[model samples]
Target chain A: MLSFTFWDILSNLLLAARWTVLLSLIAFVCGGVVGLLVLLARVSRSAVLRKLSGYYIEAFQGTPLLMQLFLIFFGLPLVGIEVTAWLAAVLALTLFTSAFLAEIWRGCVEAVPRGQWEASESLGMTYFEQMRHVVLPQALRISIPPTVGFSVQVIKGTALTSIIGFVEVTRAGTMITNATFQPFLVYGLVALIYFVLCFPLSFYAKRLERRLHVAR
Target chain B: MAYSFDFSAVFDYSDVLLQGILMTVQLTAVGTVFGVGLGIVGAAVMTSRSRILRVIVSAYVELIRNTPFLVQLFFIFFGLPALGFRLSAWEAASLAMVINLGAYSTEIIRAGIEATPKGQIEAGLSLGMNRVQVFRHIIISPAMQRIWPALSSQIVIVMLGSAVCSQIAAEELTYAANFIQSRNFRAFESYFVTTILYLALAIALRFVLKMVGNHMFKRRSHA
Candidate 1:
């Protein structure tokens, strides 16, 4: 049996970490776009749109993300779409991220004070105009910390994609563990790598939150 | 593409689904009780005067918070055996859930504790209460009242996260889904049904938490 050195494991895991980073960026960006649209529908003028988006958020948020990924990984083939782990992971994470980010941003938008909305409306601005010129800008300011924080969740969420055979950090750790039979060391390193990636973001988010509080 | 949908294949294993759901519920219930208990202790340590303990708690919180739950679960399930602690899948899953939720609720509860007005603690102390008494009477109840909703939401999230326990063969709801799908080859229908069940379970769990929070915290407002 060939043995893996610690360097081999670490270097290999780092290589796979790049995919984790890439997958996270893709999901976050795509999810942000989709989330914005869902946010519009969620807070739209029409009751049907609002209710539909509400269910959309509920469905995504209420279920475990693993189940969602399972459905995407297993369900897509029946509909004749060629399924790769990449496609399934991206699709599932995007939908999951969109639902959550929309909900979080909705809270931020609602927190923008009723008077601001009223003032914008009294200026005879259309709903979209009010949203575009007034509400979104204010919401966007307070939304930054939470949005950045949610990206940590996005990164963590990508770990689940490893189960779907995506060759990211977690999958790499599993593969290396199989080869090295050092699950304790490999998994510990995996956890440490994630902590390294996520702690700075969490710390920054907290710092930003504090600054916002102090500013207000 | 026209594919005939067959949910009947999945329904044939209703007993397995029920067993899986029961296991999931059992895991969640244990995790919630002990996890929140651990969080309370962790938060207490966090808000305590001991610097070393506080640092330790903070480190624990950050470590668990930043890492994926899947990794934590895997580490406990797969790694601990090498360290001479051979745990069953159920034990590892529940332990991981407790630890995971403990870290999250530590931060959540600490936020509530920090928000407690200093004057109230002084007042409790002035009435001859010790630190533990102050924590129990003057601090914890009101803090819990304030953060009950957040804590409840965290509990529900942990419950949903318990789905990952299936990976280690803990036989949770998702495990049932996987089993049914494997047997019937109805992956879509099985997962679809299981996802809906999760949705329903989430809603029910939220309702239950709301009721419990109301019952527990009702006296706090009057006191």
Candidate 2:
């Protein structure tokens, strides 16, 4: 077996970390877009939309993301559809993130007091107009910390995509460990890189939370 | 062209799936007990007066919380052997799970601990309860009572998360699905059954925990 230097392993893992970051960003952005729609549906006056979003959240959040990925990865091929690991991972993570982000945002939107809603209605605002002018603005401020906090979850979650043959940092670490027989060193470095990516967001989330409490 | 779905291959291996479900439930039971025990200790350390302990606890929480559980599992199962200690797949999986739950529950339980009003602790002290007694009797129950819902949900999350332990060949439910699929070549059917099993487990766990919380959260006289 050829020996890999410390730098060789670290550099290889760092390159793979790019995919990790990219996957997280794509999933986060996509999930955020879908999550907003779910949030709107959840708060809409239509019982069907509200209940539909509720089931959407429960289905995604209630199950493990690993199974979700596996289902998409294996199940799609049965219908004569082949999916690359990248596409499968994106599908799974986006659905998973949407459920969580929607729920978090829903909590914030609901936190806007009843008086605000009544006042908006009295001002001859339509449902969309009331949400746009009054409710969403107030909710946006409190929602930031939790939304940022959930982003850390999104980043960490991208690691599961590794199981489906995606060569993100975790998979790369496993591959390198196979090559170098240094699981401790390789996996330790992998964990550290994830921490580097997640900690700042987590810290900022906490700061935002504290600020929210003070504002309240 | 239409392909018909086949689940008969998976149902033929019902025994294996049953074994997998039992193993998963057993792992979660052991995991929940030890994990919650460790979380109580970690939370206590976090809140204790020692600056060194506070630093160590926060660092432990951050490091675990920020990283993925799968990597942590790999590190324990594959790494620790090189460091002189060897762990079986079951041990490694359980340890990984316990460690994961401990980190999460520490912060959760600490939030519960912190939510205890200062006057309550002082009241226990004035009643001549020792610090240990105060912590065990006065603090733990109400604190647990308050956070029972969050703690139970965390337990269920960990239960669901335990599916990843199958990656290490722990013979959990997901592992059974993999094994059955390999034998029958019915990958979709196998995983579909396994996924439904997990969803059922999560829902069942939530239901049971809600019942448990009802009993635990009942108001009792502080006296």
lDDT of 1 by residue, A1-216 (tens): 787889999999999999999999999999999999999999899999999999999999999999999999999899888799999999999999999999999999999999999999999999999999999999999999999999999999999999889999999999999888999999999999999999999999999999999999
Give candidate 2 misplaced runs (Cα > 4 Å). B219-223
**lDDT over C-alpha atoms for residue B21 of model 2:** 94
Q: Considering the true interface contacts (CA pairs under 8 Å between chains A and B), give the fraction that model 1 also has.
A: 0.87
Which structure among the candidates has the greatest DockQ? 1
Q: Indicate which candidate wins on lDDT.
A: 1
Model 1 misplacement above 4 A: none
User: Candidate 2's error at A35, in angstroms?
Assistant: 0.7
Query: Candidate 1: DockQ?
Result: 0.89
> Each prediction's TM-score against the native?
0.99, 0.97
